[model samples]
Target: MPQEPVFHRYVALGDSFSEGVGDPDPTRPNGLRGWADRVAEELARRDADFGYANLAVRGRLLGPIVDEQLDAAIAMEPDLVTIYAGGNDLMRPRVDLDALAARYDEAIGKLTATGATVLMWTAFDAGWSAVFGKLRGRSAIYNELVREVADRHGATLVDFWRFGEYQDLRMWDWDRLHMSTPGHQNMAIRVLGTLGAPHRIEMDSLGPDLPTDKASRRRADLAWTKDFLVPWVGRRVRGSSSGDGVSAKRPTLAPIS
Candidate 1:
């Protein structure tokens, strides 16, 4: 049997999801400790030599991600790299899927050429969100493209789209876009499993039930619309982004300590 993969240096690339938006952590560098951070911690536990760097920011588009992060990741000469982008691109009202996929394909080509074990993901299905419900189709398209790119380059594909575990309200945050803390933990577990890496990460349970009844759900939806949706739309309208001046959490590879 083939030996399990062990990476010395790992880099995670993408946007808010990788940045750990919903999984808030006041102690971490970005005031959030996301799945990538958890994955890095687990990897470090498995090997004391492991070093991790993440070049993810909130609300970043795929273009800047490729242009800004790809070169830096390549230069790191990491043993492993995970690329999770295109979901943000899908959120736009109109996008040329073909063009976006082509760019993504080019990126994968470059990353694979670094001789690293590249990993990519299919977007998770956020079950029934009144806010982002319609964008699911676009997300699906991006997921398919991700799968195709991963296969073509022999990269590990973390296929979240088919994972039924994410099809629950507990897996999402109030924004209905990013994953909740439990969701991030579950994702770390899934990533370790996919990579055949040893990890102590485990998901105990979904915790508690969110308000799901009609009246409560209505109030939650209104709150979501007001707090998250309006600001998001306003940002788009003004030709701005949530990551306007935000910097990457981990721009260089180093031991997690």
Candidate 2:
């Protein structure tokens, strides 16, 4: 038999999705385990000895996260690093494609320089007309940019946007902004699959087609309000619509205020 690959350390860097925002199971008494933890547990089942570290913060954009978390991620010197970010950038008032791509390039460049295998996920399509509509065409542009960066960096790109479109939105939380328990589980499965793990569930097996019922529509609307509208209102109140990005050093548990 071929020699089994040994992976001893895994690190995660990104925003809310990587942190498992909507998971009800709180791993740390006061905190949720998030997707990175879930992925770590799954890896354990394979008898892989590894230490998992999640440096993702909620509501983090590209630039700030790279600045604050990139060095820590490199210090971990992990065998693998998974990144899931850019949703917040997509929701910004003025979506600048070039800036977004440049930030992504910086992030990838820094992460890959550490010699860790990088697994990157693109943004999901929430179908929020209020925010996404104005930024139409930018999603495709961003996804392509991410793919190009991944290719250049020799990283694996997991297209969560395409995966989201093929699944039921109701599987997400009541806010429609984050994944519920099952949703996180499904994501874990897909992510593991993308990383060359043999045990993987197909997206179709997760549930019926998306937009399956009135409840889903309601959830999407609620998500728009909670995830986009409310936050935007706060940003507008602060007169900070410059898309300058926030500091990534903030507490990981601080709700996206």
Candidate 3:
């Protein structure tokens, strides 16, 4: 006789990014597979007992997530809950930062009321360029607000913005917003680390046809390095190029105690 599978219930709530927009695989029965699904897959592989329900919707904002999704998530009776939201709130016209924070607080409160361990992520700010500048500024504000709420609620705050920032822009789709396929895989790996889940298979191992060529790996690494390092270098170069009265010495790091 075949043995029944053990399962650890997990619930996720958020918007498109949490949905894994570019994950390449569509969820069985017509839903799009997002990072949440990828994370679920990893968890199951590592521990056959793991199970998850993703309540994320594409183009969802704080109001809908808080109002509709929260109830569904709580109904799942999850052992773990992951929240990734606020990007849509940032994109809305005339965003109310205070109200946004309040909604987040309420949502987290509800999730924790269920006695589930909570993991929330911060919003990304791709340094305000001509395109999406206003949205980026709002994202920065939202992230700060998220930080405060996470602290108040005692939820684990994973800084997705900083983590995503360190990755190559190519990880994102042409929209410069939603993640691409490789990005979803990378995000799953990071979330696994944050959750302290035992690693079983690397994401690369899952997609057999996906080549693991050295050149591809090298390019990804270089892209990540440049994404992280170039901005600081650029700032230095610009400061020096101005030939202002400001000293050009490299900024010193505070000594660790």
How would you order the candidates by lDDT, starting with the best?
A: 1, 2, 3
lDDT (10s digit) by residue, model 1, range 1-257 = 76877789999999998999989989888899989999999889767888899999998889999999999999989988988888878878899988998999999999998899888888777546655767788888777877888889888898888889777878877777889898899889888888887888777577778777899988988888899899989998898998989999999998996
Candidate 3 per-residue lDDT, tens place, 6-95, comes to 237777777777766656554342235666666677666645556567666666767877876788777668777888887766754467
lDDT score of residue 211 within candidate 1: 74
Give the Cα lDDT of each candidate.
0.87, 0.69, 0.66
2 or 3: which has the higher TM-score? 2
TM-score of each: 0.95, 0.77, 0.71
Q: Across residues 1-257, which tens digit of lDDT does each residue of candidate 2 receive?
A: 54434456777788777766777654352266555666676665555455777777777777766876887778767778888777777776677887888888888887888788889977666555454455547787788888899999888888887884324654676565678767877788887767656444333244455684789867867877887678767975786642245323223321221
- Which residue ranges in model 1 land beyond 4 Å of their true spot? none
Over 4 Å off, model 2: 1-5, 46-49, 128-136, 164-167, 198-228, 239-257
- TM-score of predicted model 1? 0.95
